[model samples]
Target: MTTAPAPPSLPAHQQPGAPVPLRAVGPPRLRALDGLRLLAALMVAAYHYGGRDGEISDAWGGSPTHQFPTASQFFAYGCLGVQIFFVISGFVICMSGWGRPLRAFFASRVSRLFPAYWAAVILVTAVFALPWVAYEAVSPTDALTNLTMLQMPLGVDRVLGVCWTLWAEMRFYALFALCVVLPGATRGRVVMFCAGWTLAAVVAEAANNSVLDIVLMPEYAPFFIGGIGFYLIHRYGPRDTTGWAIVAVSWLLGQHYAVTRLWHAADLPNAFSYRSSFGIIAVVTVGHLLVAAVALGKLRWANWRWLTVAGALTYPFYLIHEHLGWVTVHWLHVTLGLPAAATLPLTVTLMLALAWCLYRFIERPLTPRLKRSLMG
Candidate 1:
């Protein structure tokens, strides 16, 4: 992966007017990781509505397809990308909190995550609630829940519509913060928590409808726990190809099962039969391992300067493209009438352009300023 920019060499006893050399701090930059983020963002964007009629068909039989295997099945499996994000989040967040006090860790996380999210939520709600749009008006309770990032626990859907993942992330942050605060908690604590959370997910699934159901859903906490495990392994475990092999095998098995089942069940009206338990564990484990392999791998050509930049902008892209609204997709469908084959490429290109512009003009400059203000 691409290493961070090197600090300039400075001579000792330089003149007072001499420019000082900047020093690199924290962990070295990982370009491949950013590339992975770019891939995830693209997968999510394409999966949203980048096909004919702007809908990726589920196994429940939503639409007709020209081919024996449709693109929607691929997209359905692609939702694993979000789980990938959760794992990455766990690793990155823990690294950030390593050796830090709980207050500082919490502050840093809140500062990084909440500002952009709050802005997006406000902007989306305002745009959609316009009288001309005729979108459903969000109730006060919904707005409050979103603002507090507690909508998942409250059983209210995201006000920003695409922010359901944020609920999971916020919960993960809480659990992680607790780990940081505890006096005797080692890396093992993180593993135990993850295992416990995974078990809780299975129990919640079995129970069907209860408070535990919300907490233990694979979509909610398991991936985050997996990420924590990944961090522990990276920090303490031996670096070898064995981990990579296990990751690859798990990924293929999980992906194959999900795809085959979805494809076979496509004609069924209620195609939600595939269980999430196996897929969740497999994907989360594989996703982190893939990332770790790339980060620690010995590939000399893995570094790409631009990929790091793209990764930094990935979050903004995700936030923007996901909230473009059904109307945007409808407009494109009516105006262009593009076939499914053309939809994925076209939408991805457009979304990337928009995301890049937003990053360049808005998010990039603000991120450093916000960090300085918050951290300094």
Candidate 2:
């Protein structure tokens, strides 16, 4: 859900005559993907705290009086936006480090993930557990476990539920990094690794073992694979129908995973009744279509300032939105006398304000330096 911006090399237009740093090289910006990132963050925030589904998103169809309207449906399925982020992450990770040294690749990814993440972790800890000046308190262990951002894998609960996605993201990074660091990276090898991984995931699912789900998180493999497939198609060429085929297969499997995870799983209060079987299919289909459109050069824009700003704020926005927003809503509606209807805008505005501060202060300033120090 969060992307650390990579250092940009100079634009071709300003390269020849201008004095630019020798080590400076920036990946070309994909404004459309950036826009998508912004949208995904907002969607998840809406899905979590903004929607009538209540604080927990899985309680989607619970509010009988509000019933499920079109707006409700949008909020209910908003977490699907994370699938969009996963696909984008695969694309971004590839685009960010094509042929770069493995060291540089690692440094870039570390820089992009941990600095802001750590800061967000600290802020969220204070807000959710250790509010400096006010509010109720939560477990200290949760705050500590969250600082690692590996709570699930570490056998500790997360300080924030949304952080589960980060573990999935980290696993994808580890797998992709392994591919990039092979003795001699080749298209076939990368393809083989991703395909093999997806196959393993399928097998794991088929085995019906809960342990593999906890350890591997293979259920999400298809999205990452689809992302890599699209990246191959874009970076190499469209004629690579092989890559296109992988993407297609991945999309199909994603829908399949959705069905089993959401529909067949006898979990949740209502079990299979929580969501329609078709809802998951629709989400996967639409997500891939967006990725396809982006790869086809359809969503390109000339880097409008507003879009750039929105994109810049995405990572921090994602980091701070969920728990903090819910806390704010509780304060406004429960603690204060404000009605639920009146508290929604205030909650959103408060989260945005907090995100802006985090981006400007911690995320923006510290990331490059942290990366540089690690590289040094």
Candidate 3:
């Protein structure tokens, strides 16, 4: 699931030679980003429901191509939503982390990530443990390890497949915290970090080094790097050439990596075979363009009041949607004799309701207390 805190106040742009300060009244909440995040989460849910591989198909008792047909063709590309999320993450992280101390930054991250995550791990584990559910449940030890969000490095399977993205976000946060936040995230330092990460990712891929690939995340580094660049442009002004250059280079590289990765996945026996690599490339391009538009302030009109609530549901919705949604689909469509049309909407409604409860009841009460404890 894509997750990050709200953007913090930002210092305004300075004269070319003047030093930039750390704090000032920043722009209004990018409700548009919240809206974009919700859309991304929905896209991912759509993919898992009808466009993924044999799991959803197995649950539904029919091939996705035969079952979803036209919709599957579109939803097949929804995995690209994660790319969109990474880009948003970079932008939000840079915005939030700017001018904050390392302790405050670290505290905010822990508070934001763990409240819902711990709950989701236990909840998804319990759901999978139901006797009627077909999805295999992980051992209690793995589930406990998952609570720390270190399961990826520890060689444990994720309780929810979407947790993998949370792991990626964690790694990005670590790199940012040490390299940027710990030292202080000034404009120059942030730009340098982005450039350095982009270069290292390239080297890691060229050398085929497993360790560097894991650390650098060549496939996803561009999106996060580009997001930092966008935040810089948003903070400094549109005339920031260095920021624009970083974004431009990142967009070019992001497309290449995305297409290459998707193409490689084409051979996977259990995964959805994409219809066209070119189509995948186009979708990735669109994802970059959308974030770029937000950076340029073109989407400011999308700042509707309800989007804040929409954003609140995104993370939890993503967390529970995969394993739990699939199981519900199996029970509803296959066992209950409901049609796909009715079953899909009903399942989504139920998931959204659960996400809201997770947010309103659990996240709302726990976040500030957790942050205060960590801060202390």
Candidate 4:
């Protein structure tokens, strides 16, 4: 008697009678991951607020070091938060997109990314247009281009500094959708994609190939790759050797790139520089271990309901936080003459409140409508 084929929804390599984890195939919500996302957003916000080079000083007529002496020291490390965000994005995207249709994947990404991003661009442009604000206004043409989220490739300046990460994310989504999702994400195919991408990254680095570097994202690819491996472990159990190996190799290469590629040694006045390879490696390692812990079920205790709300706020908060937060900090501290002690917390609280409003009034309402239209 012939045996029956495995279901299409299951990984291609899943053996007959293999025990698929309920957590993998069930509802995709992981509250701990949601909470982690919010933490990452807060880290980025802190970096923008006090750890940046000279923007605070430019706005308030005092050095950031002087105003936020103790905080700046810690916040300086907060830029690593973006790396953490990228890793989370990898796991979340792979989890959400596995066994999904290509069009559905595209629609989900578009609906999720564009609404708050458009709102942010429009709001930021208006804010910068105010004569009292210290920053120059983004021109109408640039603002229009920014709404497309393709301004980086079009050679137009981003209206918000944080939007650069969105470009990286877009490229990743496109690649993953085509190579993995379109073909159907399976254990074998995903493992191959991860391995191929890893090799491509090393080749790009060694050959100084700009085209491959742009497509492959040599510096950031390992985190994304590792995240995918962790998800595979979560879905199929940690017994998978290839998945665990992929994660290990990614960590090795990721830390190397984090130290060598991220920081500059020059002491330019307005440019941020961090030369501590140890600190860079440590931060990246910690980020990896955090996600790995989640995969291994060590963070199951973190699944609080409020983390769902926290996750919703992360995207919009990240989208609007950098430039607008800077403006708010300047307005409160410089224009209104509030002390730095008061300005910092006030700015953070106000940004969080604004993030909620953006999510509730804009993203929550628009996402479904946009998804329906795109799917239709």
Decide which is better by TM-score, 1 or 3.
Answer: 3
* TM-score, prediction 1: 0.70
Identify the leading candidate in terms of TM-score. 3
Q: What are the TM-scores, per candidate, against the unseen true structure? A: 0.70, 0.82, 0.93, 0.92
Residue 226: error of model 2 in Å?
Answer: 0.3
After the best TM-score superposition of candidate 2, give how far the Cα of residue 112 lies from its true spot, in angstroms. Answer: 1.3
lDDT at 105, model 1:
68
Best by lDDT: 3
Candidate 1 per-residue C-alpha lDDT over 86-202 given as tens digits, one digit per residue, 9 for 90 to 100? 657766776566666665665677666665566566766776677755356578678767887777667785766557777677767776677554432344454455556656665
The whole-model C-alpha lDDT of candidate 2 against the native structure comes to 0.70
Per-residue alpha-carbon lDDT of model 2 for 34-67, expressed as tens digits? 8888878887876775344444332222341243
Give the clashing residue pairs of candidate 1, or none: 2-303
The candidates, ranked best first by TM-score, are 3, 4, 2, 1
Candidate 4 C-alpha lDDT tens digits along 1-376: 9967766654745542354342346754788888889888898888888876766667656767778877786777788898888889889899988877899999999999999988988898998898877789777888898889999878898898888788899998998998998988777788899999999889998889878878989988998999998888777666667778999999998888887766666564665535477778888889888898888788888878899999999898898888888888878987899999899889988998999999999998999999999999
Superposed on all Cα atoms, the candidates' RMSDs to the truth, in angstroms, are 9.2, 8.1, 5.9, 3.6
Q: Which 10-residue window in model 4 sums to the lowest lDDT?
A: 15-24
Steric clash pairs (candidate 2)? 8-25, 8-26, 9-25, 9-26
lDDT of each residue in 1-376, candidate 3, tens digit only: 8844322343324422235567653668998899989989988988889876768888889876666778987887888899999999999999999888999999999999899999999999998898978888999999989998889888897887887898789889999999999998777788789989999999999999989988999999999998998887777767778889998999899988878776655566765555477887788788878888888899988988999899989988988988889888899999999988898889999999999999998899999999999999
- Which residue pairs show backbone clashes in model 4? none
Off by over 4 Å in 3: 1-18, 264-271
User: Candidates' lDDT values, in order?
Assistant: 0.57, 0.70, 0.86, 0.84
